[model samples]
Target chain A: MAEIIAASHGLVVTQAKDISQSSLALEADVVVIGSGAGGAVAAYELAKAGKSVIVLEAGPYVPSSEFTEDFSQAIVQLYEDKGTQTNADGDLMVLQGRCVGGSTVVNGCVAFRTPDYILDDWQKQYGLTNLTVDALEPYFARVEANLGIHVNPEHEINRNSAVLREGAKKLGISWKPFQRNIRECALTGHCLSGCATDRKQSMLVTYLPWATAHGARIYADTKVTQILAENGKATGVLAEVTDPKTGVKKADVSVKAKLVVLAAGAVQTPLLLQKSKLANSSGQVGKNFACHPSTFVVGQYEEDIHPWRGAMLGIYVDEWAHPSKGGYILEGGGAGAVELSAVTQPGLGEDFMDYMANLKKLAGIVTLIHDHNVGEISWDDDKKKIDYRVAEADYPAMKAAIASAVKLHFASGAKKVYLPTVVHAVVENPAEADAKVAAIELGLQSLRMVSYHPQGTCRMGSDAATSVCTPYGETHDVKNLFITDASLFPTSIIVNPQVTVYTLASYIADYIVQN
Target chain B: MTQNKNKAASDVSAALAPLSRRSVLKTGLWAVAGVSALAAGGFALLRPSPRDSLPVPAGLVHLEAQHYHLFSRLTEILLPTDGTALLPAAQVPVVNHIDGLLDALDPAIRQQLLTGLALFDNAAVVTHFKRFVDLPDADALAYVGDWVNSGVMPKRALGFVVTKLTHTGYWMDSQTWPMVEFDGPVSRRWGIPSRGNQPLPG
Candidate 1:
C-alpha cells in the first residue's frame, strides 16, 4: 500500500504521523505528472534504474473490469469533456481519452512504427539529426516487445472491414493487414468503446502495473495545477485533488521534487506550462497544433455482412499516403452500432431504411487524413477553457481526402456512397458518386472534416525561439523541466501516434537516466 | 325462496357446464386494462411540461417532428415484416422511448422539427398524398420511406439528421444492445479471453 498524503490549508499535511513522516515525505528524484504511455515509460525506466519516481495521474485507476463494452458510459467516464464538441468551423467532434492510460486506453490497438518517409522528412525539414528509421529501430523493437505487438492475420475479419479489403482488392489499391497488440482477440468490434475482453494491451495494464511493482508511486485523481519553479531552476509541482463528481476546484498542494516531467498530453501540457508562467521564453508553447481529420463512407452491399463481428480496423490502404492528384490516406475506421447509428444522417432516413431493409448487406469504412495545417490552442483565462482553431489552408487537404475516399468506395464496388459534402452529398449509387468524381476532376471545395488525433501543441526542437522544448524534451530555458507526451511531437506523422508516443517516451526516459 | 332456488340452479349448471374461453379472455382483458390505466395515470403525474423540459428551441421543433417521421420510416425499413407476427417498427415499444426523449427536449427544438416534417409533407407533396397528417400511419410511413429510399428529398437534411438521430437514439435507449453479435459469457465478466470454440451444456 502507498502512503496517503492529504492537503490542508493549501499545504502538504501528513494524515498519519506515526509512519516516519520525514522519510516518506522526502522529495523524489523524479516526479512525473501523468501515467500515460509517455509518463509510464519514463517512470518504469527511471525506477528500474534505482531512482525514486512518483507519478501523478489526473484520472482514476480503472481496472480491467471497469473496461466497459458500453461506449456511452466509457466516453462519459474516460473521455475529456465527456466527448464534447469542438467548434472547429462548425461543431467538429473530437474524442480524447482522459484516464490514467490516456488516449491509449481508448485507441484502436493498431501498431505501426513511424514511417521511414516521415522520419526522413523530419531529418530534412526540421534539422532533426539521428532520427532515421535505422536509428529508431531498437527503440521501436523495445516498445513492441513490452506491449506484445503482433499481427493477428488468422483472426476472423468482420464483414464491414472485409468489405473494405475486398473493395481495395477490386480497385488494385496497395493494402496490408495491420499489426495489433492483441494475442487472442475475438473482435467483437468495440475497440473504440473500451476493450472489455482485455485483448487490448493499453499502457494502463502493461506499463503502469510494472512501474508500480518497481516502487513507482502513483497518485490517481490528483491534477497537477502548476510546475513550481524558482531562480530559473526546477523545484517541484503544486496540484489539486479534485472531486470527480462535482468538479469543485481547490487550493494546490506543493510537492517538492528534484526533477519534473510533464506528460499531460498535447492540450493540457501547454495549458499547464502557460498557467504556471513557465512559458515566458518560448511563446510557441501552445502553437502548431495538428490533428488528422477523418470522414466516413458507408457502402450498401448485396450480402448479409455483419459489420460488428470483426476487428475494428483490420486493413490499411497506403496508396493515398503520398501526394497524388489528391494527398491523403483513406483507411478503414470502425465503431459500434450506437455510434454508427448516431453518425448516420436523418435526411438519409430513406437511404438508411432502404439499406436497413437489407440490413445484412451494409458495410461502412472511414477515411482518415494526415493533415498539414498549423492550428493553435489558446486559453481563456476567465473561462478556463481551451480554444482551438485550425488554419483555413488545411481545409483543402481534408476536402481532397473526402473526395479520394468516395472515389475508392466506388472503385472497390460499393453500390452507393455518401460524402459529407453539402453540394454533391449522399450519392444514391456508386455510379452517381463516380459520375460526380469524374465531373470534378479538379476537386471540390467547401468540405467539412472531423479530427481524431490532436497533436503537436508544445513542440520540441533545438532552438528555443521556434520550439518549446529540446530534443531531450526539456524546456530550453528550464534545466530540470521536461515534457514527455504528444505535445513534444514536432510534426504529425502519417500514422497512429500511440506507438510513437510510447517509443519516444522510452527514448526520453533513457535520456533522463543517462543525464 | 325463488331467488335462492334460481341461484342454486345456476350454480349447479355452472359447475356442470365447461368454462367458456370468452369468460376467461374477458377477465384477462379487464386485468390488463386496470394495469395499463394505473401506469398511464402514474406517467401523467410524473411527466414534466414542455417548457419545464430540457430547453429545446422553437427552431428545432420542426426538425424534431421531422426526426420522428424519419425515425418511423427508417425503423420500418430496417425491420420490415416477414410472414411471422413480429411487431411493426412503428408499434415497437422503442418508439415510445424515442417519443419520451423528444418530450424532454426544449419546445423550440420540437418546433424546428416541423421544418423537417414540411419537407416531406409540404403543400405540393400533400396534394399527391392527400394531407400527410390525415393519412393512415402506415401510408404516411410508406410515403416517407419511398422518398428517402428514392433520394428525392434534399441531401442537406439527410446529412443533418440521419447520423445524429442514429447515435442519439441508440445512446438514449438503455435496452438497445450494440449491433455487434458475439458468443461469450452470459454474465458480465470483464478481461476474460474469448471462449470461441468451447460450448457449455444447455
Candidate 2:
C-alpha cells in the first residue's frame, strides 16, 4: 500500500493508503467495477466521451515493468485465487485474473470476432435480434484495428503450430492461424503468465491506460462490498480498500455515481450481484453458467518440437467448430515446463522422469467443447460455490474431441500421444486411439479439465423473465446498472471470448452514451 | 483465500461440502476396509497427532515439521535423486516453495490440506501398521500409487494435488530447466523490446 495517489496526463491513480480517514467518499458520473476486458473498454469509451469515471479494481496493480515471465510470480500476482478457482466438484480449474487489468492481463491473447453462427443462434433462440453479425461488425472492426489484431504470419507460426496445421491437412481438416491482439509478439511463450515486454495488448497496456489518459480515475486493491441502491436505481458502491495480499482492510471507500457498470468476469460479477441481492427479478443472476470445458493431449515427437519457443497459442482446427458439425475447437497450445507437467502422462518414479526428459520433443493440442448451460454459481458464507458438471450429453463430444486430438497427433508424426485422464493412458498408434478414448471414464476428476472462458452466468436476452440483463447490457431490474463482461453472454461462444467481450462492451458503451 | 479454500476443499473432499461429520466418520471406516469411501470421510476421522505440535523450520510460514516430512517423502518418489535423474529433488526446495504458497492460502484451506496430509499418512497404519512417513521407500511409492488410481474421488484428488504441487514446485525452479533443455525465460536474455503499441494493420 504505497503511493496512494499519482496524477499524470489528466488521470489519477489511487490506492488504499490514499485515504487517511476511516471512510473516503467520491462522486463520479460513471463508476465501473473490475477493469478487465469489458470494464476497461467501457471506461475508455465513457471517459473519452467526457464522462467523469471512477474505476475500482479488487486486484493489485503490477505493471509491465514488474512482470517476471515466471509462472509462480505471475499466477500469484495476476490470477484470481492464485490460479486455483475451481468448480464445486473440483474437477475443472476455472482461471480468472485478479488485477488492475483483470483477465485480459493473463489471457492467452487469442482474438476472434463473435462467429456468425453464434450470433444467429442468439437471434433465433434467445431473442437477441439486435446482436447480428452486421450490427456488431463495426464494433468488432474498430476493436480489432485499435488493438492491432492480426493473424499470425509465417515467422510467428513455430513448430508447435506447424504440427497442428500439418496434422489438420493430413486428416483433411480445416486449420487456420489465430487472430491475436498483440503488437509484434516476442515469442517468449508466456501469455498464460503475462506478457513481460508489453507486447500483448492486454487491457493493462491498452484500454485501461487509454482510459486513464482520458481522465478516468482508477483505484486498485479495492473490493466492492455492496451496490448501494434505492427505489430500483443504483446510486453508488461501498467498498473496502484492503491490502491485496492479506486482505486487511485499510479504509472504507464509497463512490456515488450516476451510472454503475459491472465487468467483474462471469463468476465474480454474478457473485457480486447476488451478494447485493439486487438485479435478480428474473432469479437468473447466477444461473445458466456455461464454460468451454477444455482438455488437451500432448504429442511426443521424435524431433525436438521446442513448443515453448513461440507464441503461447497459434493455429486452430475449426473443421468441427461449427455447431452443426460439432461445437469444439482444437488449438495448438504451447507452454513452459510447469504447465507441460500438468497435461503430460501422469506417473510416479522413473516412468514420469523419462517422460519429462523428453520435454523438448513434446507438443500439445487442446480441445474446447461447446458445453451446455447446466452449471450454476452460488455462494456459501462468502466462499464462491460453482456447481459445474459437464453435462452427460456433452460427454460424447468431449471424448470425440480428445480422440480427434489423439489422431491429429499421430497424423502429425507423433510417436506417442498422452491423454489427460486419471490413469496414465497413452496411445502408441493412431489405430488404438478410438478404443482407448472410448474407455476413458467421464467421472469427476477422471479427466483433467480447465476453463479460461466462463460465460452465460448472467445472460442477456429479450425476455426479462429468463435473463438478468437486457440486450443493451442493462440489468432488467436495476436502473443505470449495466454489465459488460462475459457474464452477459447468453451462450458459450465456443472460442476465446476476449474479443467478443470487447465488441459487446464497446457496443453497450455506445448504448450507455445514447441513453 | 476464498479461492484457496475452494481448491483445498476440492482436494480434501471433491464432494465434501454436502456430507455430514457422522457420514464422514462412517466413510473413513469404510476406507479402512478397502471399500470405496466418500472423499470427505478421511477428513472427519483425521486425529490431532503429536506431529502437529512438532516444530516448523525457520523461514517457512505455513508448513510444519510433519508437513515437511510428507512432501519430502513425496518428492523422493516423484522426482528422485537417482543417477538417471537430472538433479535430486532435494536440490530444489519444492517443499519450501509449497510452504510459501500455503502462506498465501486461506487458513481453512491450509487446515484442510493438513488434515488431508494427516489422513494420507495415517491411512497406511491399518495395513502396514506403520505411518506413511515411516514406511519403506517401496511401500511409500506403492501406497501413493494406490491413491493415484484409487476409485475414491478424494484419494485420487489428493494424489493429483500432491503430485501437481510437487511437480510444479520442482519444475518451476530454474535448476530443473537443464533437464528439460528449456531456455528458462528469454525476454531479458534476448533483450525483448517493449513495443508499447503498434500501428494498425494496412
Candidate 3:
C-alpha cells in the first residue's frame, strides 16, 4: 500500500521541491499563498481551469494519523501562537488554526450559509450589488456539495448535550439542532482538537486533497513575506522557507506568477499587503474588524452528563437572529476534557465536581453572539502585531445576548445556573436570578466575551475609494491580485465563516477564469 | 540523529552500571539539589503570592465567599436526605477544590474572576442567598440549582467550575453514574460506537 501510494504521487517531496534559491524567476499562471478553505478552493478551481498554480503554506503537512486527541499538543501544533491570549480589554483569548488546512483543521465542523440579512445589509449600505443572496446561492450550493455539508439528524445527542436540550425545554426558549460539514461523526467531541477519525469534512479532508490530486502543489513551512510587484502590477511573491522545528528565520524563496491570491486570513492578509506596501491607496487594508463574542452558561442536573463525549457543537438558537434585535445567534459548543478543564475555574470546578460527585447534576450551553460592528483591527508599527480593540458601542448587544441566555436557562428548568459575567459568578437560585435579570438586562457590558470568528478586516465594496477590494475580491488599487477570506467580509455574517469563505472563493475563482 | 543515538547509548550504559549504594545516594542528592534550584528559580519568576497577585475588586472576595457558602449549602439542599446513604453535598471535595483552583490561576485571570462574582449584589438578593444557605439541605439545593441554571453567575467561571466539579465527582463518586444510567466506563474508553443505540454492557 505504501509503495502504491508513493508510486501514485511520484514522491510527495518532489511535488514540494524547493524553489527558494532559484530567485524570483519562474512565472506561473497563478500563485496562492495559503492552503486553507479559500486558498485551496481557489487553487483547485484555477488548476482545473488549466491555470498553473503554486500554493505556499506556512505550517507542516500533518496527516490524519498525526491528529491526536491530546488537546494541549494539538493547540501547539495547529493553533496560531499556541493559542495565546491577546490581552485586549477583556483578556481576549484568540485561537486561529495555522497549519496547512488553516482554521478548517481545528474549527468546529458547523457549516452555515452566509446569512441573507448580512448580504442584504452589504448590498444596501456598501453599494455591493453583486453580493446579494441570490447571486451567491449557486456558489454556496457548489461549495456545500463539494464539502458534504449536512444536518446530523441521526447523530445521537450525548448525555452532555442532552442536558442543554432539557434546560432549554424547561426554560421555553426555542432551540434547534445545528447543521455541520461532516459525514459519520463518531460523537468523540474532539473536533476542536482535530478529528482523527476522518469524519469531519474540513477543508483539509476535502478541497485541499482535491487540489493536490488535480496537480496544485502546496509547499508547507514556506511563509510568503511580500507580494513582488513591477510597475504597479503584482508579478509574484517573495517568501522564506521557515524552519520546520522553530519556525524562525530560514532561507528565502521567490516565486513568479501572473496572478497572486492572498488568502492568509483576516489578520495575516492585511499584514502581508501592508508589508508589500500594496492596498494602502484607500488606507483600508486592516480596519473595521468584527468578531462574534461568545460566553458559556452551565446548569447542574441530578444526572450523569458528560458533555465532552460528542460533536463539539450540534445545536443553536436562531430565534433572535432576525432583524428584530439587530441580529443575534446562539450556538452550542463542544470541548474535550483538556479544553473543558481549562475553561472551568477553581471554585466552579469544585461545584461541578460536587454535582458530578453525585453523578447526576451538571449540564452546560454556550452563547455565541453576532455582535454589532464595533471593533477595529490595527497593525502595531513597532512590533508588526495585529492589535484588536472592541469598541464600547457593541457592548450592549453582548449584554442583551447574555440576558437572553440566562432567561432561556431559567425557562429550561436548570436546577443551578451560572452566567458568564465578570462581576457575578453564580446565581444561588432561579427566583433571585430572574428578579435581577431585568436590572441586568444588558449583562454583556460587565462580562468578558471570547471571539472565534474574526472578520471584516479588509472589506469589499464597489468603489476603490471606500473599500480595500472589489466585488470579485480583487484589490481596488492592485491589479492581478485578489483576496478570498474572512478579511473581505463586508459584515459579520450570523454564521460560521468557513463555508461562506469557500463559496466566495469559488465564485471569485470562476469570475477570474471567465474574465 | 547520530549524535542523539550516541548520547542515548551512553545514558543507557550509565543507567545499567549504576549499582553502588554510595553513588546512588550521591546521584539522588544531586537530583534533589537540581530540583530545588529549579524550584527556587521558578518561585522567583512567579514573584507574588497567589492571593496578593490576584487583583480582586474592592467588594469581590467577600461576595465570592458568600456565593461559595450559598453554593455549598444549596448543593446540600438539592440532594434529599430521605434516608439514602448518599454523600452530603457540603461534605463533597468540590468546595475545597474550588478554593484551591481559584488560588492557582494566573493573577490576572484570578482578578477578573473576582469581579465576576460581584454582579449579583443587591441587598435583598444577598440576604435571600444568605438565608437560603441556612435552610434545610433540600430547600437550599432547590434554590441554588435553579439559580445556577438561570445563568445568574459569571457564566464562564461558574460553568467551568461546575463542569470540573461534575467530572471530579463522576470519577470520585460511584453512585452518580450508576444512578444516572451512564453507559460508558469511568475512564480510558475509546473508539466510535458501532451504532448510536448500542446498549450498555450488563
Among the numbered candidates, top TM-score falls to 2
User: Candidate 2's C-alpha lDDT?
Assistant: 0.80
Residue by residue across A354-388, what tens digits does model 3's lDDT show?
43343334455666656555555555552334345
Q: Comparing 2 and 3 by lDDT, which wins?
A: 2
lDDT for each candidate structure: 0.57, 0.80, 0.59
Docking quality of model 3: it rates as incorrect
lDDT of 2 by residue, A1-515 (tens): 34212122122458766756778899999999999999999998999788999999998887776777777667767887766677876677788899888999888889988889999999998899999989999999989988879999888888998987888899998999999999888889888777888888888777876787668989998988888788999999999888765568998888999999999989999999999999998999988999999987899999999988888888999989988788899999887776777775457777788788888999999899888999998887768888899999899789889988998999999998999886668887888888999989897768878889999989999999999999999999999999999999898899999999999999999999987
- The DockQ score of candidate 1 comes to 0.05
Cα TM-score per model: 0.73, 0.91, 0.71
Pitting candidate 1 against candidate 3, the one with the higher DockQ is 1
> Number of clashes in model 1?
41
DockQ of 3: 0.04
DockQ of each: 0.05, 0.30, 0.04
Q: How many backbone clashes does candidate 2 have?
A: 0
* Candidate 2 wrongly placed segments (more than 4 Å): A1-12, B1-57, B197-202
Between 1 and 2, whose TM-score is larger?
2
Full ranking by lDDT: 2, 3, 1
